[model samples]
Target: MHMKAIQFDSPFNIKIKEYKTPTIGKYSLLVKVAYCGICGTDIHIYEGKVPFVTYPIIPGHEFSGTIKAVGSKVTRFSIGEKVAINPNFSCKDYGYDHHEYCYYCKKNRPHFCINWEAIGVTMNGGFSEFIVCPNTSAFKVPKEVSLKEAALMEPIACCLHGLQQIRIRPENTVLVIGAGPIGLMMVSLIEAFYKSKIIVSEPHPSRRNLAIQFGADIAIDPNNEVLKDVIKKETNNYGVDVSIEAVGGTTTAIEAIDCLNRGGKALLFGVSMPEDTINLNLFELYSKELSLFGSFTNPHENDQALEILKNKLINVSELVSHIFPIWKLEEGLKLMKNKAKDVKKILIQIEDNPKEYSEV
Candidate 1:
C-alpha cells in the first residue's frame, strides 16, 4: 500500500511523500489511519521549535484509524473496528530509553516517560494511510463519535491531564487565556468537570466568538476589553481563582498570572520554546502566594478522554470545524498558519466506515 506523508526536512520545508506500507512486527499492529489532527506542536515542529526530529520525520500524533493487521500475540483489536491511538511511546524496560523511576512513571505513569519517544517526533505517525503502533496505545472509539472527531481524543487527553494537575473547585472562578484549540478544549473539559464561572481571553475575533460556543461563560478580547476588569467585575473585584495559559507565549503566560487572584493557581499547559522566558512579578509571588507550574502532557488521562467521549460529556464534533484529505496535508498546515480565521478542530479524512466497531 502506498500512503501519503508530510515530511519536514527543515524549518517551513514540508513536502508530501508517498511511501510503501510498513511491514508489521511482533506485538505491533498496522492500522489504516482514518484521521489525524494538526496540533500546535505539529506547527511547532514545522517551525523547527521542537527538538529531536530526524530529517523527513512525519508529524502527526492526534489520529484515529482502523486495524489492518494485528501482530501474532495481539488479541486486543480486530480488523474492522474504529480506534483512537494515544501516540506517546516509551520503553519501560530500557534504563536509558526511559527513566522508569522518575517521579511520574515510578507509579506506572507511562505517559510521562522521562525519555519519551513521541510518535510524531521520534517515530513516523498517522500522516499516512497506515501506522504501526503498539496494541496497548489504541483506544476503541464510541459508536456516536466520528473517526475524524475521534482524532481530537489525543488533545482531549492532554487537556484532561492539564485539568488533573490543578483542582477545579466549583466555587472558584476560572479564566482560560488564549481561546485557541487547547484553550477551547480547556473550556470544554472544565465545563464537564467543574461548574465554575469560566471565561476566555483571546484577541482573535472568530476564536473569541467560538469560545462562547465551546462553553466559555464569557469571551473577552484583551485588545478591546480589559481581561482584569472583566474578571474582577465578574468575580466581584476578586480575580479568577484559577487561570490556565494554553498559548505558549511569554505575553499570555504573564496575562494568566496577572489575572490570578491572591492564592490563585496559574497552570501553564502550553509547552513554550526552550529559549522563551516568562517574566513574573516576584512581589506578587511573595505577597499573593501565587502558584505557577507547567503541565507537559497526558498522564493516564487517555482513559479519561475516551470515557468522556463514550459518555458524551463533551461534544467533540461541535469543535471539528474543517476536514481535508491526507493528500492535502500542506493545505491543512497552511490553514493552521491562519488558524484564527479558520478556528477549531480540523481533521484529515482517511477511511470513513459505515459502522464503527470495537477494533476499527
Candidate 2:
C-alpha cells in the first residue's frame, strides 16, 4: 500500500511524497500515525547541523499512533489499540548477533548503545500516514491520554531521563536555563516530581511568563535582567542545588555552572552543535565537588511518561501551542525552527480522528 509521507531528501530539502507502506512481519505491527512532533533535532537535521543523520530520511522521532493491523505472531499488541513510539534502535532486534558486543547494552543501558541508530534520524520514521515497526518499539497508550499529548511521550521520556541524572531532592532549588519545550518540561517535571522551588531564565518575555504559569517560582529575563542577581536573592546567596542547561549554548552552560551551589549537580539536556564548546573552570569543579551529567536520549522512561500524562500530573497539553495537518508539514517545521516565535510543540496531525480509522 502507498501512503503520503514527508521525506527529507537533504539539507533544507523536504517534501510530501508518496511511498510504499510496508506490510507487518510476524513480530511487527502496522500503525496508523496520529501525530508526529517537531523537535530541535528535526530542526538540526533541516539545517544540516546534526552530524550522524543521513540524508533522505523521515524526521520524526516523537510520535503517537494507533494499531491498524497486527502480524500473526504479534501477541502483545492488538488492533484498535493506541500507542506511543520509542525511536531508539538497539541490537536486540532481528538476528540479534551483537548480544555481548556493546558494553552499554550489556549493562542494561541501551540508550547508550555503541551502534545506536534512531528511527527518525537514521531510519525510516513516523512522519507518515502509516508505519510498520517492531512491537517492542510500540508502547500501549494510556486510556486517559489524548492522542495529541501522546505525541509528546518520547520527549517527556527524555526529560524524565534527565531528571533521573541530576537527582533533584525535595525542597531543593532548581534553575532551568531555557523556556523551550524541553526546558518547560523540566520546570513542570521538577514541579510535579521534585516538589521544589524552581527558577527559570529565559530571554523571551512571553516564555518567562509561561514558565511562571507552568509552576516556576521565579522567572528572570536573562537578556534584560541579571540572572545571577535573581538567583542570589532567591536562594539567600547560597545558589541553586541543581542547574539544568537546556539552551544548548555556551553562555547558558556557563550561567548554569555559575549559579550552582557547592556539590551541586548540573544536567546538560540540550543538543549542542558539533562545533560548540564551553570553557569550564576545572579548579572550581574540583574544589566544589560538582557533578556533571549528560543526558543523551530516552531510556526506559516511556511508561512513566505515559502514566504522568494519564493521571494529568504534568500539563503537556498546555505546551502544545500549534497543530498542522500532514500536508502542512513544512510550515510546521518552519514555525518550530523560528527562535523568536513563542512556539512550544508543533504537531503534524496525519489523520483527522483516530477513532474513525481504528477497529474499535
Candidate 3:
C-alpha cells in the first residue's frame, strides 16, 4: 500500500509524496493516523534551523491514531485500538547511560526519561495516513479525550516534565515570558496545579490577550508603559516566586531572570537558538540563590498530559484556533511561519471526517 505524507526535501521545499508501507519491526505496530498536531519544531525546520533533517523526511510527532497491525512478536496491542503516541522511543538496547536521563526508568520517576529517541526526529513520524511505531511508543487514548485533543500529548508531556523539574506551591506567584502555545500551556498547567496568581509577559497584543483567556491573571506587553512596574507590583516588590521563559529569545530570557523573586526559579523551556546568551547579574543569581531549569523535549510526562485533557483540567480547547485539511499542508506551514492572527494549535487533518466524507 502507498501512504501520502508531508516531508521536507530541503530548505523551503516540502512535498506531499507517496511512499511504500513501512515494514513492522519485531516490536513495532502499524497505525492509521487520526490527527497530527503541527508543532513549533516543524516551523523551526521550515526556517532552516534543524541540523539532522535530511531531505525527504517526515516531521510530525504529536499525533493520535488507531492500531491497524502489529508485529508477530508484539502482544501489547491489537488492531482497532484507538491511541495517542508518546514520540520518544529510547534505545535501551543501546546502553545504561540512557537511564540517567530516564526519570522513571532509573528511580521510578516516570516523568523524566533520561535516554529517549524521539519518533519524528529519529525516524519517520505520523504526518501520513499510516505509519508504524513500537507499542512502547504508542499509548491508548482515554474514552473521554477526542483524537484531536490527544494529538497534543507530545507538547503537553513537554510542559508537564518541565513542571516536574521545579515544585510550585499553592501560595507561590508565577510568571511566564512569552504567550506562545508553550507559554500558554505553562500558564494553564501552573494555574491548574497551584492556587497562586499567574501572569504572562508578551509583546504581541493578540497573544497577550489569548494568555488572559488561557488562565493568566495578568498579561503584560513588554512595550507597554510601566511594564516592569506592573510586574514588580504583582509580586509585592519581592519579584515573582518562579518565572518560566517559554520564548527562546535572549531578550525574553533576560526578562524572566529579572522578573523573579528572591530565591526564585527560572525555567528555560524554549528551544533557544545557538550562540544566543542573555546578560545576567551573577550577584543576583548568587545572593538570591536562583534556580535555573533547562528543559529539552518531552521525557516521561505524556500520561499526565493525557489526564489533564481527559478530565478537562485545563482550558486547552480555546487554544485550538486554527485547523486545515491535508491538501492544504503548505497553507498550515505558512500560517504558523507567518505567525498569523489569533493562531494556536495548527491541526493537520489526516482523514476526512466520515460524517463529512460519507461512510462506506
Of the pair 2 and 3, which is ahead by TM-score?
2
- Candidate 2's C-alpha runs over 4 A off are 95-101, 353-360
> Can you write out model 3's per-residue Cα lDDT over 128-185, one digit (the tens) per residue?
8898887777778899998888888889889988888878888888888888788888
Which whole-number lDDT from 0 to 100 does residue 41 have in model 3? Answer: 81
What would the TM-score be for candidate 2 when compared with the true structure?
0.94
- Runs in model 1 deviating more than 4 A are 92-104, 352-360
Each model's total of backbone clashes:
4, 0, 8
Q: What TM-score, computed on C-alpha atoms, does each candidate reach?
A: 0.91, 0.94, 0.91
Lowest summed lDDT window (length 10), candidate 3: 351-360
Error of 1 at 189 (Å): 1.5
User: Which residue pairs of candidate 2 clash?
Assistant: none
| Arranged by lDDT, best first | 2, 1, 3
Q: Please give the lDDT score for candidate 3.
A: 0.78
User: CA lDDT of each candidate?
Assistant: 0.79, 0.86, 0.78
Backbone clash pairs for candidate 3 read 101-113, 101-114, 102-113, 102-114, 103-109, 103-112, 104-109, 104-110
TM-score: the better of candidates 1 and 2: 2
